[model samples]
Target: MAGIYLHIPFCKQACYYCDFHFSTSFKYKRELVDALVKEIHLQKNYLQGETIETIYFGGGTPSVLDESELNRLLAAIHANHTVASNAEITLEANPDDLDKAKVNALRKTDINRFSIGIQSFFDDDLLWMNRVHRGDEAESSVKRAQDAGFENITIDLIYGYPLLTDAKWKSNLNKAFELQVPHVSAYSMTVEPKTALASFISKKVYPPLNEQQSASQFMQLTDAMREKGFEHYEISNFCKPGHYSRHNTNYWRGVKYIGIGPSAHAYNGFTRQWNIPNNARYMQSVQQNIIPAEVEELTEENRLNEYIMTSLRTIWGLDLDRLNAIAGGSAPLLLKAARHHFDKGWISQHEKIIYLTQTGKLYADAIASDLFF
Candidate 1:
């Protein structure tokens, strides 16, 4: 089974800290959707007939697309590919877009999951981040989605913002737990260069993030989540039993997936490709029956690094047995390098599986790289 991802490149407003490929103007919205539909047909065979088990509608804000447009895109995908009957279709939505009517409209489709972007539950944090939705709207949106019959819902939360105190961070997690939200994806706020947040900090318009505070909040999050009986299945994701995100899990497990739309990526377990980031250029190229993408053939080292990067972040640690076959018997070299961390109690090996300890998860990337052969 495989997956499909469609990037909607239109947003009503540019959040202060966002650096994703998007345009605030919807001048070419119709044209872009048409191009995306064509791209779907053009790339149908990319996954090589693997049953599509997941379909993800990701940013700039899939919620910005109307129900009719979304339906058209879904129809195009179904017409071209052999989608599984019980595929886990997800749409990444923002809080401002979820009204009773819109949520009801979404329920008419095959989308079984909703990943709402509710970055924070405080008004100050939302304002500082220039988010379009207010705190109350965030809560209301989730309520509406639930009322609309979306049982498999996930929310995105951000912590470590300069505006968030330790108490506020805990409150955010506590609110999600109160809501009985089965899945949650949280991220530490980081200022990317060229983002508005970076510019603001450079000019003293906004306070900079505190790394120590961020680390403390992450520890608080992990502990609170454990107490609430949520599984830290991935570094940034937690879920109740049986509520894990099948799409993202498939991604971390290294299943093949094709990503459509401008600036989206595709992987086939061998090579990776990404479309050009420019929307105008992408539409123009696809208009001429060409796919505007750059491809890279994966080398052994590249594949190993990728496996280390993704697998180490998940509850399923690196499988030494599978690594031996994929790495052509050089897997022991990787395991040998991991002994230092094992001795330090940062990671443990049991039944040939290597997993990061709670202490090790804080430095997950660093530990994974150290074990890279």
Candidate 2:
């Protein structure tokens, strides 16, 4: 089964730490949405007749679009593709965009899941991040959605910033737990180059994120969630049993997906393509019957490295038999290089499968790199 991802590239306000492509203006939103619809039709044949099992409406802020606007996009998708009856459809939202009326209206749509950008339930954290929503509104939004009969919900949290004390971090985790949110996506704050936070650090207006703080908080987060019976199913995502983000899991497992809108990416096992990142250019190109994207056909080495990178970050771990299929010598070399890590108890191997231990997950990216051919 395949998936579809739509990147809504407009945000009402920009967060200080974001590097994703977006426009803070709605001047061209309607036109861009139309371009996205057109792009969907143009790329409908990319996945070779695979049934869409997941449809993820992700972006600068998917909730920024209203009921009619969202309905139009969903209608376009249904008209062009064969979608599963119970496909997992997710919309990435913000706390400020969700209210009782909005939540009720959303429940009437085809979107069955929500990944709300709560970030933090603390006023100080929100201010530091320059987020538009406040602490009370964050808590209210979750409950409001739950009360509106939208139970399949997830919330995002950030840690390791200078102002986030250990106590505050602990409080943030407990708040999500108390609210009984089924899925939690907690990420350590890493300053991306060219973002506002990066400039702040460069100008000495803000301190840089400490690696130790991030590592410690991650350990804290994993322990707390596991204690509450939430599974650390992915590197940054934890969830109650049977509530994983099917859309993301599908991507990590290398299922083909087509991405629509500016700066969106698509993969079909052998090649990857990304649309142009400019809104106006994207619209013009779509109007002129062009995709305006770059494509790269994956080499054998690229496929192996890609598989190792994504699979190593999840609970499923790396499959040795598949590695052997890709290259007969790869599994043996990987096993030999990994022997020391197992000796150090940083990783565990059961038969042909290998997964990072809690301690090792902190350095998952680096370890996956080491294991790459």
Candidate 3:
């Protein structure tokens, strides 16, 4: 089954650390949504009529769209595609947008999953990040969504901000565990170039993220979640039994997906295409019956590298047999080089399947690079 991803490229305000392709301007909202609908129709055949098992409304903050707009987009998608009856439809929401009315509206739809951004559930941390939502709003959002019958909820959390103490990090994790959220995706704060946080660091206005604090907080998270019987299925993801994010899992498993709207990407095993990042240009192009996007045909080496990069990041790891199949038996030397990692106890191999050990997980990206053709 394939997946579909829609990128809504508008946010209420910019987070200090955000580098995502979003603008705080709502001037282009209606046009952008219309363009997204048109793009959906334009790209309907991209996945080759595969049953779409996952539909993700990711962002800029998908919850930013009002109810009617979201319904229109979803209706357009259903009208154009063969969506599965029980597809895992996910909406990426921010805490401030999860009010009673929005939650009710979402519950009325087929959107069965939510990935709420509750980056740090402390007032100080939220202020540090310049997030519009407060600590109370963050907690209330989850409770409100649950009250509105959204049980398949996951949340995003950030750890190790300079303003976030270890105690606060533990509190954040404990809140999720206490609330019995089925899935959690956590990340260590990394300053990206051109972001406000980057500028602040460059000017020594704010202290840098404490790497040691982040590492310790990560270990604390893993241990805490494990104790709560949550499976550390992927490096940054934890889930209760059978509650993994299907859309994200499909991406990790290298399933074909079509991404819609500005700055979105689509892949179908051989070629990858991305829409132009400019919202105004995207709307004009779609209005003129054009799909404003760039495409690239994957070379043999690029395909191998892509597989290595995505597959090695998950618990499934890399399967030599699968790699051979994807490569059509052309790159024996690539798999041959990985034998040393297996011999050195960095990776475990059972016939054609090779997975990382706890130690090897630390060096996963490097190992993948080494095995890349």
Candidate order by TM-score, highest to lowest?
Answer: 2, 1, 3
Highest lDDT scorer: 2
The 0-to-1 C-alpha lDDT of every candidate, in the order given, reads: 0.91, 0.92, 0.88
Which regions of candidate 1 deviate over 4 angstroms? Answer: none
Candidate 3 Cα errors over 4 Å, as ranges: 328-332, 339-345
lDDT of 1 by residue, 164-194 (tens): 9889998898889888899999998989999
What TM value does model 3 have? 0.95
How far off is residue 230 in model 2, in Å?
A: 0.2
For all predictions, the C-alpha RMSD in Å is 1.1, 1.0, 1.7
TM-score of 1: 0.98
lDDT (tens digit, per residue) of candidate 2 on 184-254: 99998989999999999999999878999999999999999999999999999999999999999998888
Estimated TM-score for each candidate:
0.98, 0.98, 0.95
> Whose lDDT is higher: candidate 1's or candidate 2's?
2
Ranking by lDDT: 2, 1, 3
